[model samples]
Structure formats: C-alpha cells, structure tokens
Target chain A: MKNFMALISGILFSLGLGLSGMMDPKKVLGFLDVTRTWDPSLAFVMGGALVITVVTFRFILKRKAPVCEQNFALPTAKDITSRLVIGSALFGIGWGLAGLCPGPAIANIFTGNVQMILFVAIMVVSMIITEKLVD
Target chain B: MTISSEFTPLLSLSGGIVIGLATTLFLLFLGKIAGISGIVRGLLTGKKQDRSWRSFFIGGMVLGGLLISFLKPELTAKVYEFDTFKLIAAALFVGVGTTLGSGCTSGHGICGLSRFSKRSIVATITFMAFGMLTVFVMGA
Candidate 1:
C-alpha cells in the first residue's frame, strides 16, 4: 500500500512539474535570472506548493505516525553547518548553469535526449560519491 | 534586463497544488518526504527492504513527463541548451551539493520550509542567492 502511494505521489509530483513548466530548463533559468528577463510563473508554483504544504503538514505531523507506517521518516537534521551552506551554494551554482535539478532531470528521462541521459548519469554518480565521502 | 510578462500564474499555481498534494500524500501515507534528491540517493544506496517502493516512486517520476506529453502533445519542449561539457559539470555539482546539503529545492524549498525547519530555510536562501549570483556572473 505504501509503495503504491509512493508511486502515485511521484507521478503526481512529476506531472505537476511538467504542467507547471518546471521541467523546462529555460523556464527555470529564466526564473533564476532575476536581473534579466524573469519568469515569475514558477514563483506561483512554489507559493502554491508552499501554502498547501504549510497547511497540510502540521496536521499530518501532529499524528505521531503516518497512516501506513510505524513512524514518520522525516528529515531530522537541524544544524546550520558549513556542509549545508557550501553544498547548497554549489547546488545553486549548478542549477543556474544547467537549470536542471534532481526531479526535473529524472522526469526528463522520457525525453530520450542523450544530453539528459548523460546529465542524469553523471548526477547519480556524483550523488554516490558524495554519499560515500559524507559517510 | 527586463521583467518577463509571460506569467502563467494560474497554471503554475495548479501545478504547485498538484505537487503539494503528491508530497503530502507521501508524507501522510508512506512516511517519506517526496524529495527527488533523497529518493535518488536511496536508490544508489539501497537497503533491500526499502528498495521496491523507492524504485516504484522513481519509475513513476520518469513516466510522469511522458504521460503529460502524451496527453497534451503541444506542451512538449526541451530547453537544455547547454553544451555537453557544461551539462556534465553542472550535474556533478548538483549531485554532490544535494547530498552534502542534505536537500535540494523540493526537499528544502518546498517540504523542509513547509515543516518550518530552520536549516532548510537557511539552505534555500543560500542556494537561491548563490544561484542568482552564478547566473549573473556567468552572464547565462
């Protein structure tokens, strides 16, 4: 049941990403290019997502555990370490350069674009390398 | 440097609502944060017991764009105009950064901030500011 839910959620999320133009690298870069011609549409997407999340999350979190699980597997780390800031800064740089993030890049797999494939492959390898190093 | 007037606020809002709904479902039912970076990380470093659901979730994401393209046909477009080397370099940074940062835009920007985690708030601001700076510096 939980697996099904995860699958469903992933699909819905990706579908939203596609429909909202989040999957478009140009749109993403445009949004980030605030000093230049900017696309404010993605802000509405973030705002819309944030509002729903803020409303629903607190209520769901109040329940101790999720509906189908023994515990809520939430992110618990809360330190403002250099790793967090440096890593984020790096991610932002990459995002600005390529306008590709994990979700959109993953969804772009269906495009059959060799460039997307290469990008995703490299991204995965980098994740693994970082995971090992961090551990 | 001009403001773009091609704002699709309604479309973007509906899309965001869908994303929030999907993420909320994952949190409420699966007890997982529907973060793409974390999910991808899990796939790379899999615990046998947690593998199936993760795979299913990833598979769904891969198909999501395909499904939408199938339905709309006209909405299909590719904006990855970067050169081969640049794309690869960016991917490396994104992967490492997300892992070390412990979250990406969706994880921190959407889910983390929603949960009001101070760490995420800091990370989101840092990334966005740096991202803007990078674009400005590179003139991209």
Candidate 2:
C-alpha cells in the first residue's frame, strides 16, 4: 500500500512539473538567469507549493505518526556547514548550466531524449562515486 | 542576455499547488519527503526494505513522463540543447553536489523550505545565489 501510494505521489508530482513548465530546460534557465531573460514563473511555482505545505506540514507533523510509517523520516541536522554551502553552490552552477534538476530529470526519463538519458546515466555514476569518496 | 517574453503565472502556480498536494500525500501517509534525489540515492544505497517504495515511486515518475508525452507532447519535448562536455559536467556537479549537500530542488527547495529548517534555508539561498551567478557568468 505504501509503495502504491508512492507511485501515485510520483505521478502527481511529475504532472505538476509538466503543467508548471518545469519540464523545459529553457524555461528553468529563464528563471535561473535573473540577470537576463528573467522569468518569474518558477518563483510562483515555489510560492504555490509553499502556501500549501507551510500550513499543512505544521498540522500533519503534530500527529503522532503518519498513516503508513511509524515515524516521519525528517532531517535533524541544523548546523550550516561548509559542505552544505560548497555542494549547493556546485549544484546551482550545474542547474544554471543545464537547467535540469534531479526530479525533473528522472521524471522525463521515458521521453527517449538521448541527451537526458546521458545526463541521468552520468549523474547516477557521479552520485555513486561521491557516496563512496565523500563522508 | 535578453528578457524572455514567456512568463507564465497561472499555469505555474496551479502546477506548483499540485506538486505540493503530492508532497502532502506522501507526508500524510508514507512519511516521506518526496525528494527525488534522496529517493534515488536511497534506492541506490539504502537498506533492502527501503528499496521497494523508492523503486515504485521512480517507476511512477517514468510512467508519468510517458503519460505527459502523450497528453502534452509539447511539454515533453526537449527545448534546449547542450554539448556532451557541458552535459556531463552539469550532471556530475548535480549528482555529487546533491549527495554532499544532502538534498536537491525538491527536497531542500520545497520540503525543507516549507518546514523552515535553518539548514534548508541556508542551502536554498546558497544554491539560488550560485545559480543566478553562474548564469550571469556564463551568459547562458
């Protein structure tokens, strides 16, 4: 049941990506390139998502446990470390260059775009290497 | 760089709301973050019991892409083209960076920010700044 729900959630999330124009790399670039060709659509996307979550998460988390899990697997770390800063900076550069993030990339796998296939393949390998090498 | 004439407000907001709704569903029932990078990493390296749901969720994403291709072919079509070197460079940065940073756009940008985690707030701001800077530098 949990897995089924996950599948449904994934589908819904990808649909949102599609409908919001996030599936387009150019669109994403347009937003990221604030100095030039700025598009405010992505901001709206985050705002819309936040409006629902900022309120809903507070209430949902007040519960003892979620329906399918014994506990919420939330992040506990609070310190702002250099690792976070440097890594995020790198990720941002990548996002700016390609305008594709993990979610949108994965969501578009079945589109048979050779470039996307190459991107995901390299990303997976890079992630594996990073996991092995990094603490 | 020229100003893009394409600015979508209503569609983007509606889509974002739908994305938020999906995350809510995950939180309400599965107690998951609906974070694509984390889910992919977990599927690659997490415990055996955790793999099933992650795989299903990823499968659903592929299925969702396929469905969108049929329903909205224009949305599924590729818009920008990148060279091999740039693509690999970008992918490498994204993969390693997400791993080290512990989240991606979905996890840190959406889920973490909504919860108002200081770590997430810092991460999001850092990435956004750097992203804009990169575009500025590269003139892309």
Candidate 3:
C-alpha cells in the first residue's frame, strides 16, 4: 500500500518537473542566472508549490500519523554545521554547471541522455564516498 | 501571471502545483519526505523496510518520464547537449556536495524550507548563493 502511494507520488512529482520545464538544464540555468538571462519561471514554480505545501503540511502536522505509516519520519538535526555549508556550496556549484539536481536527473533518466547517465553515476559514487568518510 | 519571454508561466505554475500535490501525498500517506537524495541514501543505509518504497518511488520517476515522452511526444522535445569534460566535473561536485551537505535542491530547497527547519533554511541560502556565484564566476 505504501509502495503504491510512493510510486504515485513519484510519478506526479516527475510530471510536474517535466511539464514546468524544471527538467530542462537550460531552464534551470536560466533561473539561476539572475545576472544574465534570469528566467523567473522557476520562481513561479517554487511559489506555486509552496502555496500548496504551506497550506497542506500544516493540516498534516495536526494529524496523529500518516495513512500508511505509524509515525512521521522527519529530519531531526537542527544545527547549522560546517558540513552543511561546504557541502551545499559545492552542490550549488555543480547545480550551476549542469542545472541537473538529483530529482530532475532521475526524472529525466528515461531520455537516455549520456550526460545524465554520467552525471548520476558520478553522483552515486560521490554519495557512497560521503557515506564511508564523512561523519 | 507575468510569463517570462522565454518560458511559459501558466505551465510552470501548473507543474509546480502538481509537484506540490505529489509531495503532499507523500507527507499525508507515506509520512515521508519526497526528497530524492535522502530516498536514495536511505536505500543504502536504512533498515530493510525502507529500501523497497524508495526503489518503487524512483522506478515511478523513470517510468513516468518514459510515459510522458511516449504519450505527449512534444514534451520530450530535444535532449540537452553536454560537453563531456564539464559534465564530468559537474557530476563529481554534485556527488560530494549533496552527500556532505545531507540534501539537495529538492530536499533542502523545497521540503526543508517548507518545514521551516532552521538548518534547511541555512543550507538553502548557502546553495542558492553558491549556485548563482558559480554561474557568475564561470560565466557559463
């Protein structure tokens, strides 16, 4: 039951990304390129998503548990550590270069783009490295 | 709706709404954060129960992408071109950065900030600043 829910959610999320032009590396670059092209479309994307999430998440928070889970698995860490800062900075630099975040990269995988395959393979390798070395 | 000259605002908004709906569904039903990086990581580190749903969700993403391209046809459009050298460098940065940071654009930029987590806010600002700075610095 939960797996079905997860699958459905994944499909809808990817659909949104595809339809909104979020999957386009060029579009993502445009959004990030405030100094240059400055496409405000993704701002609208973020705004629209926020409008829905902000309202609904509050309602969900009031509930005892989710439909498929006994408890909510939420983030627990609160401190703003150096790991967070440095890691995010590097990630952002990568994002700037390729405009392909993890979600969009996976969502666009079906396109059989060699760049994406290389990007994801490396990304996974990096994730594995972080797991072994990073505390 | 002020549409950007190069992009369509209506479509972007609708797309975002759908993204939001999917995330809300995750929260309401699965009690999970629809964070791609975290989900991927969980498949590696989480208890046995955690891996299956994550795999299913990722499968859905791949399947959904294929479905869109197959059905809409127009949405597939042109596949983006890549420069091999730059692409490799970018992917490495992504691997290290996302892993060290504990999240990515979706996990931090969307879910984290929405949850009003202080750490997420800081991480979000850091990444956005660096992303813009990187582009400005590289002039790419």
Ranking by lDDT: 2, 1, 3
Per-candidate local distance difference test: 0.85, 0.86, 0.82
lDDT of 3 by residue, B1-140 (tens): 11123767888899889988989999999987788888877777667978899999998888777777666534532367767777788888888898889898778877887888888889889988888887777754
iRMS, model 1 (angstroms): 1.8
Write model 2 residue lDDT over B102-130, tens digit each, in one string. 89889998999989989888889988888
TM-score of the A chain in candidate 1: the value is: 0.96
User: Which is superior by TM-score, 2 or 3?
Assistant: 2
Which candidate has the top score in TM-score?
2
TM-score of chain A of 2: 0.97
For candidate 1, the share of real interface contacts preserved is: 0.78
Model 3 residue B39 CA deviation in Å: 0.6
Please state the error at residue A36 of candidate 1 in Å.
1.1
Which candidate, 1 or 3, has the higher lDDT? 1
How many clashes does each candidate structure show, in the order listed?
A: 0, 0, 0
DockQ (C-alpha) of model 3? 0.66
For each candidate in turn, the TM-score is: 0.95, 0.96, 0.94
Error of 1 at A21 (Å): 1.1
- By DockQ thresholds, what CAPRI class is model 3? medium
Q: Give the Å error, residue B51, model 3.
A: 1.0
Ranking by TM-score: 2, 1, 3
